[model samples]
Target: MELHDRRQAPWHDDSFEGEMVAVMTVGVPGGEVLLETSRLLLRPWRVDEAVVQRELWTERDPRVPPHRRIDEDGHPTVAELEDSIRTHKVWSTGLLAVERKASRDVIGYCGLVDSGRGATGEPELAFELLRRVWRQGYATEASLAVVGWARSSGYERLWATVWDWNTASRRVLAKVGFIETDRKEVDAVHGTTLFTTRPL
Candidate 1:
């Protein structure tokens, strides 16, 4: 797929009054999420990535847990993932592509997922990354960016659901200011999931 990486401040040295007004009104307030930290870029999920299924799905890396791996071999099949992405559940909300800037390779994702409604049933946050990119502080960086996004966009809080055994994620959540608030196991999914929350 042709990756468009220039989603950021379009204004440079060249400026026209008409364009400048447009930039100030929309571009400045609507900051593009091309978040970078010298290593990775936390960008939106792109469509057209079927060939990456095996690598993203089946790999037994520490970065992702067993349940979330949609593929048996590596990554989700292009067809399956595209289907997921097309669904409003996956496409409208939830998910991102964690890319290594130097290589433009999508190692994995660190993003938020909508967990239905809160007491009033608000949105939720879920995140993950490939094992190859784990423990290098990329998760924290991307998550912080997500938090900023949630706050800037008027989200009140961000929540996370994680397996009890995933101490690594627990730590990352704490690092990003999430505290263990509640726990519930989705019988439909059949695994004990801890629900943690933090104000945006």
Candidate 2:
């Protein structure tokens, strides 16, 4: 499992969604990469999953990166999350509800954001999982699939911005193959931090 140099990474001609992705077991080759890993399924987001959507607001203290959390109110309303989903419909993003199949729970979301492309213009990757699901590899798994989608879907890179102090999100971004692509100080409506990314 030695990592390949990004400089020499092979560029596949196949466009995402045009062909069936190859999903393979670790150490196996030539399988379509749908990225349906154990305990998680990477898919699209829906507005109906709002209660879980409120995880964006509810799980903030001590965990959520500054950029990910909502306002000073410290509580994200399901109405706000639902409005977010409805707004995204006007422009498509890979925003998906991360549901735990065993419990049929809509725990939270992970996906691409149309804006915040960083200096490199890589579509930014974003996620806000319920506090209950932290440390379970769900964020990493979902982010991996998102990175895969970005690669296969004609995108040369992906980005994620985080408060440098948010160690958990920093860990998730690192686990998903995004490197520190860029940084800049912006007036923090809330907290002052920025972490951007490019292709791995």
Candidate 3:
């Protein structure tokens, strides 16, 4: 998938214009920073983990819409994963791998992204864990950290989108203080998408 260009300012609602200007002045973080939670460590993508990241793309849950899964051809090639890592490296505050503190295993990725789906161009929180790790509260835990990081980074607000069928994700957003917004969109594969947001 094509990544959002981090060089551009995130979109925001009209009421947030002043806050958005303030965020732009502060700018993005300059380097990777480790975020620690009770049971996980969130850190930058590593080149050696390309294969692990590719498995994540290809092994999504069956409930996920086709368009959100890996391409029909198969798992992303190693080269593709490397390219993705390179793109992620460009954004100082982009996605990071979630490592379980107990096993030291990388289970998934969670972080912020600039999204146009809301037409607000603001940063959107995103996360996906391996199917094996579902229902373990990892998503909510990692998300809380990301939200806290955004607030401390000078963002005025953050946004997110969830497929209507993704009740689990919706709950996770709620746990992290995101409220459903009036904005919605329909996609050919993912069906109806609900937008949500929270102030930083």
Ranking by lDDT: 3, 2, 1
lDDT by residue (1-200, candidate 1, tens digit) is: 00112232332211211221111111422232344444666655666653443455655444344565654464456777777765534532346676777888877776556556343333566666777777987677667766655554556777787766688888988888888875666543434677788985
What is the TM-score of candidate 2?
0.67
Give the best candidate by lDDT: 3
Judging by TM-score, tell me the better candidate of 2 and 3.
3
Please say which candidate is ahead in TM-score: 1 or 3.
Answer: 3
lDDT of 2 by residue, 2-72 (tens): 01111123233222233423222222232112244445554445667776666556557754455556767
- Deviation from truth (RMSD, Å), model 1: 8.6
lDDT of candidate 3 over 52-86, digit per residue (tens):
77778777666577665787686477787887777
Provide the lowest-lDDT 10-residue window in model 2. 1-10
How many clashes show up per model? 14, 9, 4
RMSD of 3: 7.6
Identify the runs in model 1 with alpha carbons over 4 angstroms from their true place.
1-38, 60-76, 86-93, 186-191
TM-score winner among the candidates? Answer: 3
